[model samples]
Target: MDLLTLLDPLMTSPLLYPLLAGLGSLDGVLPMIPSEAAILTAGVFAHTGAPSLLLVVVATALGVFIGDHLAYGLSRSVLGPRLINRSKYARRAVAVAGRQLDRRAGLLIVTSRFLPGGRVTMNAACGTARVPLSRFSPASAIAALAWAAYMAGLGYLGGAAFVENPLLGLAVGLALSFACGGIVELVRRWTARRAPRAAGAADPGRGRSPAAASRGQVGSRRVRRALVSATAAVAVLAAPAAAAATPKEADRVGMRSRLDDVVATGAVGALAEVRDEHGAWRATSGVAELGRTRAVPAGGRFRVGSITKTFVATVVLQLVAEGRLGLDDPVETWLPGVVPNGRRITVRHLLDHTSGLYDVVETLPMPPGPEFLDNRWRTWTATELVARALANPPTFEPPGSAYAYSNTGYLLLGQIIEKVTGRSYGDEIERRIIRPLGLTGTSLPGTWPRISGPHPHGYLPTLRDGETHLIDYTEMNPSMMGAAGEMISTTRDLNRFFAALLGGRLLPGHLLDEMRTPGVRGASYGLGLDWWDTSCGIRVYGNDGDALAYRSWSYSTEDLRRQVTVAVTPDFRGDPDHVVDAFLDQAFCG
Candidate 1:
């Protein structure tokens, strides 16, 4: 099971409410406690019916109220005087309460619950002063309720937008909470700066006569009140819309909205496929190509970029299983002298992107622009490409060092396969995987430029003569990418391939384990496959692909029961990850 799936039971446990309440109670005394995260997390769980929303709010309020009284109780205790006398902070707290808490205590208490450290200081100060229980208790109760409502309400809002991923919801809640605190701080500073000026002007003969000064002060106060009232009114009116977007409504609107959002941001076209036990849902938004009205093809093929790595890695692992290649064997054992540190780099290093080889494409003066356009038709040999990499210093100590993504490493791996089998990498892949799996929609186009059958036209944005131009980059030689990336496949073909691979149709169990084991720090890479911790808490394993004009991804749960695939042609302004996250959250989290 993925992390979120394992965490769901814990989040929904009946014991969670009391725990959250306990934390809330402590928050009044222990300002550092992350009560907001706990409350918001519980509130997020409420969206999934893990717990009732009313129960969560009430529990949170009860905890905070108990904590408030506990601090007050401590203040009235025999040791209260000694404690206040010994601690400078406590003495200062009392001074602050004496000056301001007498008048604006209610507002300060309510807002302080949202501010870090403010709750502990205020509650402690109020207790140290021995303020009447009658005066403090009722205000504390109301303040607790308001804080609970705001925290829970914000959590619910974020949960609506990010239902599958409680962590993301928590982060969003914290950001919103912090933003509220920041706005309050800014307003306080602004008011403080205005106070001295207003006071100086109010003095007789300082700027104007007493009558005129009084009128000016009144006008200034009126303007400040209007500003504060307007801000409050806008927030009150906007609250309902933000809180009312239910999960079902979010699901209904999210996918299309994400697609439209990406398109509007600059994508020429976007398409996605989500598959689960229920069935598959396909969606498309934006045009197939610029200046065309055709919708993106429903089952269109696009270059699956580095996604080809998975297929390549699978075949290599198959060879390892067949006793034809050794994972620990040095690259020098196959294509001797090709890489600078081939003797130190193992086959495993190549597969997991730990070879530390510098990416050959980075050496070029420009990529995917006018400079690349000049050489777009040039074919690149794998040996020639590796030589270009060798010409540069190794990116790091190679052969099992730091993780660095290098197309050069995969190209060398492809060459090694050719050396071992006396056949091109594409031949071995087709004979072993694609043909046997009946994936007719997939192909290694090599030097062939035209996309056959139904395919969306890929686009690349360029600047020429101070104006942006969308170029049709649908046709290009794949020889430059070679075995590393030059493959074409549709969403249907990708889904089939990943599902089969994850379902154990492609490799034995041990090899599959190896493929899923992340070997490098800070990257969830395992062989050609990688893992994504989605916004909805589930972990999905897949590879993402990026070409000059097209981008694609194929991901599946560990059990192969759920999957998502997407293809997009660049519109130049948005990242496809947002749409992918929303779509996968709905598909897998639900």
Candidate 2:
């Protein structure tokens, strides 16, 4: 018989809740009672309206809470002292746990519940450390609730999505749970491996006099600083070896190695492309999906998020060049009473993000959790989106007085483009930029939910019971983002578009200069494009884009000779940005 057939009677029985509770409590002490499996099975059955979902959640949480406290009390009274006295390793582990508890006891306690064997270890550590009941109780309660909700929610989602085959739903839910555990374990192991290398990099003068050690450390820092400065200068100024000399194979290796590091930091997949006077090079790392061995597509299209602002801004500039729109014209002239401070806000104000408009995206249900799944397919009209923003007062009085990044401002810019050209915002972008540049991989998806081409699936990492639940968020209605961020494009298309824009193929020299000029003092953003001053003291212009689970960056040198575009589906557990920065340093600073 199949596993489900054998467990069917127990799952549908009145004894189910008490059985779940008993198993949950026993698992805390024994560490192998399969409490999670029991909970998941009950949850799957609960979806068919047998044992109540609410009862299942409550029973599981109650059992876990009781078990955790029982473990804590036993360790405090008996097991903890015996272990510490018998093993040096146990003592050292407890000492480390003590230090962590002193800093963030609640967070450590809560997150531990999700890790395999973490619950027992932390309970023993906490008890030995003499953590007070008052502090521990609240954190434990929250952990129990979060754990029950997440596990039950997972089964419910699976059941809902695959109603025709309930057994398949149960299997899928269990698989996802195991995957989350595996990812957490892998991240822990990876971190442990790095610790030794970091320790080795520290001072080697532990046996020397304090004065001698201090002097040696100072000298070492100075030498490193000097080397960094020199390397930065060479990396920034040197042309691609293909253009000036022999191909730099070492540089290509360095880029690939850095991309691998990015994946090791918990990104599911990453794709990057770099171009220069010599030629173009591409690199990818990690799997496109969680359980599959499929590689990320070489020419994958992804939602560009706020990077769409650059394209929209370019279209607005083209209108300016054609005498169809003016930079200083009041927004009131076009929209008329749509914005509270319409007369005060100008086209320049909108492009530069100095209009002080409140961001509408903040008010939407775009959180990286269950709420996103509930509303992912909901389409929104631009009028309704703008009205939501208009309902709130302007962020600041007298536009252009300060800078605030507002998607609302861009939505208004899109409306202005429509007013002037008598066309939709996406239509204008297509006619003005996409067609002219022949960027076949780029498009404004409008309300369409699918990517419509080869693309890496993006996942929203939700921390449940301290485990990372990667929800596939690859498809969603883009109309909510409107002209503020709805465009999709591949890294190759992004690179070509930026190169053409910066190379003066699209905009006139004078207009392009205006687009690159920052409106507010000490701000990084200009009219449409933003500039990044790398650690090597070289400025590269581009924009970064972020949606629910996808993020991308496109950057290039002033002359368009060197350019790089990157896209990543972040796992959100590790610091992907640090590795990305390192990759940029290698690409631009050599």
> In order, what lDDT does every prediction score?
0.67, 0.68
Model 1 residue pairs with clashes: 164-536, 165-535, 165-536, 266-571, 267-571, 345-399
Please give the RMSD to the true structure for each candidate, in Å. 31.0, 20.6
Clashing pairs in 2: none
C-alpha displacement of 307 in model 1, angstroms?
0.2
In model 2, the Cα lDDT at residue 475 comes to 60
lDDT of 1 at 258: 61
Q: Candidate 2 has what TM-score?
A: 0.58
Which ten-residue region of model 1 has the weakest summed lDDT? 207-216
Candidate 2 stretches with Cα past 4 Å from truth are 1-248, 462-468
> What TM-score does each of the candidates earn?
0.57, 0.58
lDDT of 1 by residue, 71-93 (tens): 76665443553465476676566
Among these predictions, the greatest TM-score belongs to: 2
Q: What's the lDDT for residue 105 in model 1? A: 26
